[model samples]
Every structure is written in structure tokens, then in C-alpha cells.
Target: MTITQKIKSLPLTFLLLFFTAVNIFGQKPNIVLIISDDHACQAISAYGSRLTQTPNIDRLAKEGAIFNNAYVTNSLCGPSRASILTGTYSNINGFKDNISYNFDFNQPSFVKALQAAGYQTAWIGKMHLGDSIPQGLDYYNILPGQGQYYNPDFIRSGNVQKRYTGYVTNIIEALSNEWLDHRDRQKPFCLIIGHKATHRVWMPDLEDLGSFDDKTFDLPHDFYDDYATRKAAAVQDMTIAKTMRMGHDLKMYDPADSATFEDNIKRMNADQKAKWFAYYAKIKKDLDAKRPEGRALTEWKYQRYLKDYLATAASMDRNIGKTLDYLDKNGLSKNTIVIYMSDQGFYMGEHGWFDKRFMYEESFRTPMVMRYPGVIKPGTAINDFIMNIDLAPTLIEAGKGQAPAPVQGRSFLPLLKNQHYTARDAMYYHYYENGEHSVSPHFGIRTKRYKLIRFYKRVESWELFDLQKDPHELHNIYDEPGSKPVIADLKAKLLKLITAYKDTEAAAIFARAI
Candidate 1:
């Protein structure tokens, strides 16, 4: 009750507080980064999409933090990945878009960073960052960018070239299992498990081809956005009506569709030409006898799309379960930090579009789930804005190490543990659409209530929407005089963000003009 009595208990009280904090935040948990290509958050069951079946992805959210507001700096494949790797934006890393260019892996990555921090690093499956896989990535079976879903060629460490005969998911899983079985167990491991699933021209294994044959997929509400105001949306290379390639995706060029073999052969050249003709010959012969009709036809394509995407994901989910089982079987789950995420969200018939590039809600949001054994209390949903670049700094900070220099993203370690933590006021987003495809360039910033977008080039326009009122982003508020003041404020913040992220193009142009 006296001052001396309180002073005598101070050391014990301090020791108890320190121990409690330490127990809540584990020291150096093994990090497992599971990234999927173009796997939209809408596809995962955890995000409340009832269409697809993804139990493993659901389990991660059930066990740890589910980041509802997770986003990517760049919505495309390569640039977003560059942001993920370096914890910086596309302009800073020089991988602004996906073109004939490749990402320079020589730069600092989370793999090299964790490896430096005494963790054994391995990258399995798709590393669509660039062709050249850097040296210190412990084990690699990466497919440069958008590797084949069937019979993919895997490049092992010993310069051995081997053609994997099974589906890509199966191959990736097998290789990852091998790496796990043989990896140095004494040290903490950082395994980067990437899946080349649910990308364009979706292909499925023969066994899974008839899985979703009976289900009729519900079309999205905005499946037919006329693009009258959003002209840039009309010029995309992935329009469902015509732009989606028939031969590659729609199966319109199958030999059965064409009466003669020569007509089928017209689209092919050399080996790829012959291979497609042969595959088409078999399927064509089957179709000629009895063409699929009415509900059968609808079911056929549904099966094609469903099995094609889900089969790949099925293998991935199984393999993820394998990894989790390994951690548990080996008594490592208690000390492991597992994260499952996608490069960016993809269109599942939304806006009648495919691929990721446009700054829509589906493409803009990515699936991000983290399970840090002792640190992150399970089932915490963080509604604040989080992005791709933040993953690295968060990992470094969680490992009881100081965050390195040149990280554009801030760590959300506080939000992970503290339920009452306040995160960023606004999340900045910018995606350049001039790449191999003719997707128009654009940039934007999103707040909880308002969104500001600026389309590039001739007669550039600004789009402002109060997201609270227009959650679907169907109506443009930028033109309305009532939203003008709000637009000005968000635009100023967007410009400030461009400067903060070292967006060189915006800097030079805006500075000289303003």
C-alpha cells in the first residue's frame, strides 16, 4: 500500500508484462508464403463466394487473420509481383507492366532477405516475376511467367531439364514435397509455394474435365457494363464477347466445329499445331457421333471452366494440406507462420471480362491470410487497407529483426495482434495498363468511403465515387458538382502518395505542369 511496497513489486511486474508480450508474439516463426496467380478473393470461400470449393484457403482464415481490405499496388501479374518481392512500387523496381520485359531478380527479395536472416528459402511452382531465377533461392521449379498448365517444363537447380507429364499443380506439389522432405530441418525454412492456376486459357486434367458438368454458373450483376462512360473498359484484350480467344479459351476452333482436319490444321504451326490437331482429333471424333445439346452444352463449358480452374486449385489445396500436415506431423506448426495470398484478383465472369489489369473491385482486392503460430490471435478480421508491399516488412518485423531500408510499405504487425489497432487512413493504388496488351493506362487511390481514378492519355478524365453509396463503382461521381470538393481532396492525397511511392512518371509530368 506504500510507495516502497509498489517499488519492490516493480521488477516482478515488469518481468510478467515482458513474458506476456513474448508469448503473444513468437520469436522467429517459420514463414510459408503460398501465392496463387490470378486467383481472385471472390473464388475463395472465406470471402463469402459460394461458387468455388477451397477448404484449405478457408482454413487459413478460420485459424488466423483474414485481411478483407488487402490490395495490390499493381493489378497485373509481373509488376504486382515486383512490388511483393521488394516491398516497393512498380516504378521503383522498373517492372511497371507485363510486356516483353522481365523482372530483375538480382534485387533484394523476401527470399534472399529471409535467407540472410538464417532461414532456408525455396521457391516452388510459378515465379512469374522474370525468366532468370536468381541463385540463392534454395530450391526452384519456377515457370518464368504464366507457365503451361499441362505438361510443364520444370527447371531444377542442377541445370537438369525435365518435362513433368502430370498437371502443373500436381508437378508443383510433388517438387515442393521433395524439397520439404530433403530440406535442412535444423534451420527455419521459408518456402514460397506458388500456383499457376486460374489464369487465362484455363485447362483441366482429363479426370476433372467432367466435374462441374451439372452446375449453371450465375452471371454477375454487372456482367454487361456497357462501357459508355468507361471507354477504356471497352478496349481491353479480354472481352468475353469477342476478345477472349476462341481457340485458346472458348474451344470454338476444335476439329468438330470445323468439318475438315485441314481447317483445324490451319491455326497450328509445327509441334504446337500438330499437338492441338491431334488432341482435337480425338475430342472431335467423340463430338461428331453425338454433339452435346441444350443443358448438356451448358454443362459442358461449365465443366470445362470449373474443372480447369478447380482441378489446379484442388491439387494446390491438397498440397497446402500436405504442408500443414507436415508441420503438425513434425511438431513445427506451433512455431510456423503460414500465409496464403494471390498475386491479384481475377474476373470470374464479372463485367464479362477475364484476366487482371482493370482497376475493378475484384481485380483490386487480393486474398491475404496469415497464421503466425503464437503471435497472431486466430480469427481476427482487419477491415483496414493492406497491400502487396506490406508482406515483406511485416515478415521481417515478425522475425524479431529490424525492417530493412527502401520499403515503401509499412508493417501491420500491430494490427495483427491488437484487435483495437487503427491502421492507415487511406490505401494508395496505381496500375499502368500499357503492356503487351492494349489495356489503357490508369492510376487511382481508394479510401474507405471515396475512390478517385484518373485514366491516362488523350482527354484524360477523373472518376470519383463515394464507395459507401456506390459499392459496385457503377456510377461515376467525378462529373457531379456535389462530389467536386471530395474529389479535390482525394486527388491531392493521391498526388502526395505518388510522390511517396516514387512514381517517376507522375512526378516529372505533374511537377513540370503544376
Candidate 2:
């Protein structure tokens, strides 16, 4: 038989198996996914922020592509991670909030797909999914919970908890490099270096302490927003003025007075504690001497908060450079795909808020930069709508593997190749952790120029913003005179997205709202 006739005569099952194997083996790129917790795009210089400079992070953008409109399905920690791993929304993955809940490790993760395709997988640092590490990972060294900033206890492979005496960011980088050195060189690997810096109670590395003291950080344009018309905005308790505490968040607690600070540093070794105490002692002294009342104090707290947060980020950026250097030294830079992203976006004192939950631009938009030597062009900026849910699917496609049937996220590989390619027109989001920051559990849809949200759980409120006209999301134009048409259109789109995504609960809630 001729070649075409012989192939046609083959069994259908055999053909399917042959193609699947061929796809898996076609392109075996090593993937390094580095994710930071609660790090905002506004803090990165590549994202056009003047607050701080991140040369290492900017290097990724200078050498690769920077996404301008990357977002998350849920703007919380655990849920966003679940979305990234499973290529599904929080509702589908069953980790809709940060509250205590077990992640179903049996689910089909892209890491498992990579492993099955002859790739070694490892996860280092903070995988804040839960107590148990997910299956299919060859090695893991993760923090027990949120993980500590100083002298953290890491749960290593085989469930062994080991306490390392060092700054969390430095330790994470050291462990990541160690793993890279020991990983099997016979196969391409997928490693996730999860950083615990720039999270809540932002603690800087001792070396980075007082790094931003000379810079006078400016307050956000809407720092004094009164939430005049937006009910949801007015009621949230995450404002830096009221919610961020001096002792807890700003770290202004006197080492000798505040038991919380004393207990936190107690885990550190003598040298670590001594350095920490000595650094904070000066901050405590300055705070006590300049006891400005009212708004002055609030502004002082904001300055302190921003300085500490930026210092933490500085260490993270430095470690990123170390990882990149490892790849270059090993001659793996040409074949490795390095990705840097945050679990979700954070509020950098925007709207006077310090935490994330709302669908506002500051909290909703995440920073994502990727470097794949030959595939993605240098200095490329993509404005397409991409979400955390799309991460797994993209990785699978990059590995020359197909996304599973249940995956809801679409790979933006086409856009990476061609900038003009259009991705999703609208993105969906759901925030379920309510009452934590006095934020109502809400769901919404964001188009390129418009955003419509329904704060449903506690208070029945609707907010619509013409992002083109009001980029800061300061106004609630849902009930405005000329906004009826826009609101109706957005509602229709939101319902369609909910139905298409199989969000049964959100569909029902949206139906009642309409």
C-alpha cells in the first residue's frame, strides 16, 4: 500500500494515540513559574509606576513581553492559585475564598500534564493552597500556611517541616537554586518559585531596611475618596486610614511593648532578632517623637506602609535576578520559559485601601511578564484580556500539549505570536470572601472600557463605570440618567458569560438582580 493508503487503513484509536504522543514530544520547554503573593503591578517600574524601581523585573519586560491587561478570576490568594493550577474559575475549582478549605489535589493540573509528558516538576517556597502538598509534584518545599517573613517553617518533600533561619525571600531563592542544581538534567523541568514577600505584614529583608526612606511617596489621587455614590466602596473596611493598623500592618509596634511583634520575631535566631529589633527600634522612636494626630498620622502610616512594602519587593526583584542568572549559567536560558506574576493585584493605597477584593483597576489588574528567548519578542506589550485561569492552558499549549476538556481558560499563544490577534472581549470575576475586609461578596464583568458589578451578599448594590471616562472607578454610574443603555448591555453580557462558563450560582443571582 502507498503511504497515504497505509495511514488511512490504520485504526482510529491508534491514530489518536499517535497524535497525542507526537504532540507531547514535539516541544518540551522547561517552564519556571514564579508567583508572588499580593504584589501589585503599580509597584513595578515596567508597569509605569514611579513609586519604586524594579530593574530585575524590568529586565523580563525588556527582554520579553509585558502584559498590560492581565487579571484574575478571583482577587484573593488561594482562589487565584487554584484558578492558575486547574485552568478553571474558583467556582469550578472549589476554592472560592481564602478561608480554610482543602484543595482537591486529584484534579487535572497542568503540572501533572507536564509530568506525564516526561518533565520533572518542583515547587519551592509558599504554595498557600493548604496543608497538604498537591500530588504529581516531584519535590516541594512550601510554607505551612501564609508563611512567615523571617525564619519561616517550610514543609519539605515527604511532609517534613524544616525551620530555616533567614529572610524568607533569601531562603526561597537559595532553595530554588539548590533544587535547580539537583534536578534531573535528563528531562525538561517545571519549577514554581513562590515568593512570600510583599504580602500582609510586609516585612523587609534586614539588608533592604530603610531603602525607601529618602523617597517621598505620593498618595493616590483618590486617597481621600469618600465613596460618595458607591455604597460598596464606602462600606469596605480595608482603607489604609481605618483598617491598616499601626502595629500589625505598618510594623510600628514597639519591640519591647507589642507582644505580637515580640512573638513574631521570637522564631528568628539571635542575630536575626537582634537586627530586626534594632531596625524597628529606630522606627518606634521616630513614631513616638513625631506623634502627629488625625490625617497626619494616617499619612505617616501610608508612607511607612509603602516604604516597607517596596523594601520587601526590592528583595523579591533581586532574587528574580538570581534565578535568571542560574538559567544563563546552565545554558538553559534558550530553552526555558520564565514567567513572573502575582497571585492577584494589590491595592497600593488606592482609594485609601491596602488589601485586595474589589474589582477596581488597582486590585483587579495583575502584572505578568514572560521571557521565552525565541518565541516571545523583546519589549512586546499585549493589551488583550488574560486571566489567571488562562495560565495553565497557556503552559500546556507551550509544552505542545492540549488543554483538558474541563479547562475554561483559552491560551493566548496566538497573541504572543501576533500582537493584533484579539482575545476575550470581556472577563468575568467573582469574589466570595465577604465581611473579611467589610467587602461584600460580589461578581462582575469587565470589558475593555466598561465594568459592571453587583455587590449581592450583604447589600444589594450595583456599580457601573465607564473605564474610558472614569479610569479610577470613582463614580457609581449604574443609576445615572444616560447609563441605562450601558447597564442593560453590560448586564446582558454578564449573564451570557455566566451561562457560558457554567457558573450556575452566579447565573441565578444575576437573574434575580435583573
Q: Tell me each candidate's RMSD, in Å, in order.
A: 6.0, 6.4
Q: How much is 306 displaced in model 1, in angstroms?
A: 5.1
RMSD of 2: 6.4
Best by TM-score: 2
lDDT of 2 by residue, 1-514 (tens): 8988998999999999777657544558899999999999999999999898999899999999999999999898888988999999888888887785768888888888888778899999988887656786999999887999888899988889898888999999999999999999888899999999789888899999999999888888989999988888888889888888877777666656655545456687778778777888898898899888899988998999999999999999999999999999987887789999999899988898898988898888999999987679898997878998889988987887667787999888777767455679999999888669889889999998999998887777889998999999998888889999998899899999998889998888887843
Name the candidate that leads on lDDT: 2
- TM for every model, in the order presented, reads 0.85, 0.93
Per-candidate local distance difference test: 0.73, 0.87
